[model samples]
Target chain A: MIPTPDLSHLKASDYETVYEPAEDTFILLDALESDSDTLKQLRPRLCLEIGSGSGCVSTFLGSILGSSEALFLCTDINPHACSCSVATGLQNKIPLNLVNASLADPLLWRLQNAVDIIIFNPPYVPTVADEAWTAQADRGIGGAWAGGKDGMEITNVFLPHVSALLAPGGHFYLVAVTQNNIVAMQQRMKDIYGLESQVVLRRRAGGEHLSVIRFSKTLAVKTAVFHSNTSNNEVL
Target chain B: MVRLITHNLLACHAKGCTSNNFPLQFKDVQIVVRESEFNPDFLRGFIPKIEWPALVSSSRELGDTSLSDQLPEMLDDAFLKTLHRVLFEIHVEEGVMICPNCSHHYPISNGIPNMASSVTLLIRGLPYLASSWLNMKLANDLKIS
Candidate 1:
């Protein structure tokens, strides 16, 4: 007996469609909750999501956090997302602060290490120009898949920011496809910042399985490693 | 935990501040390497939202410069492993994010960016107070009007 979600469609820059979530959004939200619970061993206190296609993810998150004494902020680079989030919040009886902003902007947001969890379902498959690139699918320019060439460009931009929003011990869940060069991406994540991350879930379809990645950040605040010689990369 | 995402959102716009005061640059950065299993799918999906050159150069600046100039020709495990580490595993625990043009420095204390300097704080808070004061002034103006 799920409550009806407020539905609305927020349009994106071009060729990108923002669907205000109704039903399908529930399953995705369920997936995120299920995955997030596994990581924290309980429902978290704070949750933030980006690229929320419709208000579904936003709705789900709001409800989950609202049930707890928590806060939820749903942001999308698309204008449509901003509107949909508002409506969805009202429909679901959950409170949400909607932000219509892209990932490229410097986050002036005040939430610092306050988020206990972060979730994203990014566009993974590269658009071949011939492939159907919808507003829903084309999360970015060079291709519908946000990260260019290797589907990590966007993730790279996002990873460090994830740390800022998370608390001392926080979790991040990201979903993607196998087409993005995985090996190199993993290595880059490892060699660059020394944060640990792994894929916790996978589903196969037509030789492709949707993959879910769950990552956690350690206390990276500078004072944690003041004695280290080079402050730039302690433990390097 | 200053996220590159957060970094992209900040600009040093103190009073009369202008110039390329954006994309707060990283400095005195610290990188940590922790290994987590790889997920090719996640990496693939995340490609759409990235600032490619910023990521490439930032990684290089932080000293995890293994990512080649181009995407890997193949999805070989060895190659993906490296990419995975660089893209996800590394962490910047401490540093200052400085504005390239305005020389505005956003300090990253404890992996969290102090997006505010005292100047920014006073500047931002003052306006709210000013507005409230202005409203009071407006009430007085009403008497005159």
Candidate 2:
């Protein structure tokens, strides 16, 4: 197993302004690690991580795809997190390009149907919409977890853009909790965006039942189910 | 700092400025090129995704005239190496990226771009002491130490 990126460069004071790597961050890393072979097979050219706090996840991805020509682009609302991401990338010898912007705004049109891999471990904590908006507006550590109204407000804002952002055969990995109604999210993505999804990993951490769902564009749901059944029958 | 891969994806997001916002113009740039390990296979796969004209012009703006104005039909090893250098090595450490249509200036200093400068307010109205106390406790609980 590839070890986690060295984040020793980040001091405690850095965490004061940035969202420190926690359970959510670890699960995202684990999901990536588990899918490393598949990801490498995808031969991704551009990998984008929204809400890349402390640069841990991106750096870990950098480690997996190591010194390749693949561009590891990261965005964070918190400027401090962007700075930390740069520092972490430097420390780990991973060349990470960080844009301190909210949820891929400036990147939309240009990046439309271009990004090979997109990952978002957004603010999935349940909170009032006003508080989440305030945190988002603040662009501080508060923005890390002040997810509004069922923890889907921020995630919801970014969802519609996913279908637009993904390249052909591109994959998107999102971190969510039970409160976010995972089934509804999957159904919504299927109905609206035609992005088929399946739960990749799940773990109960403290109060949050965290799950990482992986979505792909234009994947026919019935075909996947039929294919799985055929393979199972073949094994039998 | 802006890299070609980033510049390739950036467009002006200033309100009410819509069309032709792509390929933001670089101005008064101080570029530092840091050598990175070249991976030919990766670059070979990535070439198709590039906005060739934008990259060529942006690299030219950064004072690296290594890449041709057009994407070469044939991508050789030497050419891929140059493409890799232009895309990954050159960093716009100190500069302003002016929006093509809106004229919004995104500044880069100390190797990090201040893209969120428009929203400059941190969580407000709380006493510094109380906020720090809360942040510290939260950080510790999150095992940020």
Candidate 3:
């Protein structure tokens, strides 16, 4: 089982992180547990953690969720991030498939429209400059904290791919910070690929708090279903 | 490099398109429909942000309309199923999309679109097209440099 994250040494500002257990692990668990649907829907099978910072999120989910039931595919654009996450998953005995893949690559993996639950704890601290970007936070955002500037960069690129990877009736839980242009960011989220969203969790610390937004994919319209046999020939 | 899905995210509210200047029409239409799996989760997650009228109409124009005119009151199993096919399954293989606003045309051939516009002409018809054009550049960077 994953070691429960200790929030004793951390503050809200710590949430703008780069794969530290002090921050990410706590938030992921909070996001999963507080949200009933996220907790229930993400039970088993293929789980894709898009930005597996240090693998804490995936490892925690794999261990806490029961490793044997679901397999975790931990992916990251940065090699360092990928190694860290992979190391954690391996050390924790979590069922993880570690890969160095960008969120936007269609050919990165064999999972083409076949993932059950999709999760992203992307680089919400957005930045547009490469020079100012951190080597650690280069998952996107150029490494500086400018929440709105680059939050959607990954979202926009990865949004379409989520449609191609998510299994039917799957759930996608992505978290981002709303420092600026929250309305525009919210609108962008709403408009892309038809995600219904809600801010389930928020933290207030050091005069700044982050909100956790969860989005789920609904079943398509009735007209598209054809006759298929399933006592429960569950195709997910 | 523009995709229809990207197109649907756009509206024609440029400098001059005020009346009936919407549902950017696709011209010189050529399309390529590629089969990508239907991830209902993503689709379901995506519905709220969709401009219902825009998505449904634009999708229909491309001959794959499935979403209702109004955002359906119920996200029924049946509705979700149809939405799966229309939103996720039906890929825009080929077509030319024209903005109903500035009469600008964005063409999609081989599942790729020519969203390139000169700086001054970027706002000629649809500013949304500009973003879509930038996205196409990013997508192109993924391969075929």
Which candidate has the highest lDDT of all?
A: 2
| Model 3 lDDT per residue over A206-231, tens place | 44456666665666611122111110
Candidate 3 DockQ vs. native: 0.02
Residue by residue across B12-124, what tens digits does model 1's lDDT show?
54344444555557888876665544656544533443455666666777776787777766767777677667655666667877767668665654444443233332332
Write model 3 residue lDDT over B1-145, tens digit each, in one string: 2344445433333333445544567655555544544445555655653457777877777687566688788787788777656654455546666666467665554444333322222222133344555777898997777
Once fitted onto the true fold, the runs of candidate 3 whose alpha carbons sit more than 4 angstroms away are: A1-18, A22-25, A36-42, A104-112, A128-150, A180-183, A221-236, B1-145
Name the candidate, 2 or 3, with the larger lDDT value.
Answer: 2
**Count of clashing residue pairs in every prediction:** 87, 0, 48
How much lDDT does each candidate structure score?
A: 0.52, 0.80, 0.52
Question: Cα miss at A40, model 1 (Å)?
Answer: 7.1
Model 1 spans > 4 angstroms off:
A1-16, A19-30, A36-45, A104-109, A128-147, A205-208, A219-236, B1-145
Residue-level error in angstroms, candidate 3, position A6 = 10
CAPRI tier for the interface of model 2:
acceptable
Worst lDDT window (10 residues) for model 3 chain A? A227-236
lDDT of 1 by residue, A1-236 (tens): 33445453334432344543432244355556666445335445556777665556756655554432344555565554555555566566665544434431233233455566777766555542222122223333322243333444445446555555555567767776677665555566556644467876566655555667666767554212111111211111
Best by TM-score: 2
Q: Provide the TM-score for each candidate, comma-separated.
A: 0.49, 0.87, 0.49
Model 3: lDDT to the true structure = 0.52
